[model samples]
Target: MRRGFKTEAKTLALELRAEIGLDAYSPFDPYAFAAEYGIAVVQLSDLDGPARHHFLKADGSALSGALIPNGTGVVILENDAQPLTRRRTTMCHELAHVVLEHEFGVSLSDERKCGLSGDQEAEADWLSGEVLIPSDGAFRLARANATDEQAADAYDVSLAIARWRMNHSGARKVMQRARAKWA
Candidate 1:
């Protein structure tokens, strides 16, 4: 990411949430967000083939999701066989790539390798986290002293993702520092 990328992502996430009639405090729906952007979302089960089987497997090695750029739009294919929470994260991840306007390079190779540069991928991952649980939402959760599982349930995200957002977003640390200062 660049100097201003994180700030930009935070603003975009909150704005997009508002555009969908959701406040920064509400859970985000990637499917609705994708429809708003006119991006298509398809499930891997909707496909039929050996590749689908490979990608749909519940194993840890299975593909999470993929983004394909169309002429002026994009489509997201997610591994629906996974848990719903995992699917949601994957959808947002693919949407993040589109939202970031990342120039594609194959996206998926013959060996199922992602073509995005590491930086681009990292940027997308961070941006997707913002989209799923905006900084404002995370901050509110932290202020309430919400647990990771509570945040996950509230945001409809996985426990790991919720914990990552809560920990890395600095919301908890900020609140802790504020409490200590006032105490």
Candidate 2:
């Protein structure tokens, strides 16, 4: 997690708030915000559809969303009946991709390439996390959890995303030790 990304994410969140007439740092709703921004929204009935794989691609590889060039529209998979928290986080992640303008005329295949070494993706993920789980709130949740799953459920996000946030928040060693002891 870079300082710059955090700064930029907060900045963007504020800008979005003003643009949408939301109070500073109000709860973010991707669907509403996307609509307000003049970006077309496409809903997929396939989010809950059984696929032969682990991810559900909305535009590119996996269940990720990409903003079309010039911010024309945002394509997202509709995760019907999924936990609200999970849906919110995923939407936020897609929004991050859009806000960062990652879809600037690039082919979908070229954009779907995910290798762990990519800082851009990491930055986007970080931005998504920041926007969804503000730092103070995240820290408070992390402190009360007995397990990663508990934390994930509390935050309405995936365990991997929760774990990553924990690691970045300096709670990794404690959380890991707790898990090891309990496991």
- Per-residue lDDT of 91-143 in model 1, one digit per residue for the tens? 77777778778864223321112557677777877888888889999999999
C-alpha lDDT of candidate 2 relative to the true structure: 0.56
In the range 39-157, model 2's lDDT, one tens digit per residue, is 66544444344641334545543433333344355555434335456566656766666777664322122222222336666766777776655554455665566366766665556
Please list all clashing residue pairs in model 2, or write none if there are none: 56-63
Quantify all predictions' global Cα lDDT against the true fold: 0.79, 0.56
Model 2 spans > 4 angstroms off: 1-3, 10-28, 46-63, 70-87, 105-119, 171-183
* Lowest summed lDDT window (length 10), candidate 1: 104-113
lDDT score of residue 22 within candidate 1 = 91
Candidate 1 — which residues are off by over 4 angstroms? Answer: 50-61, 105-115
Residue 161 shift from truth in candidate 2, angstroms: 1.7
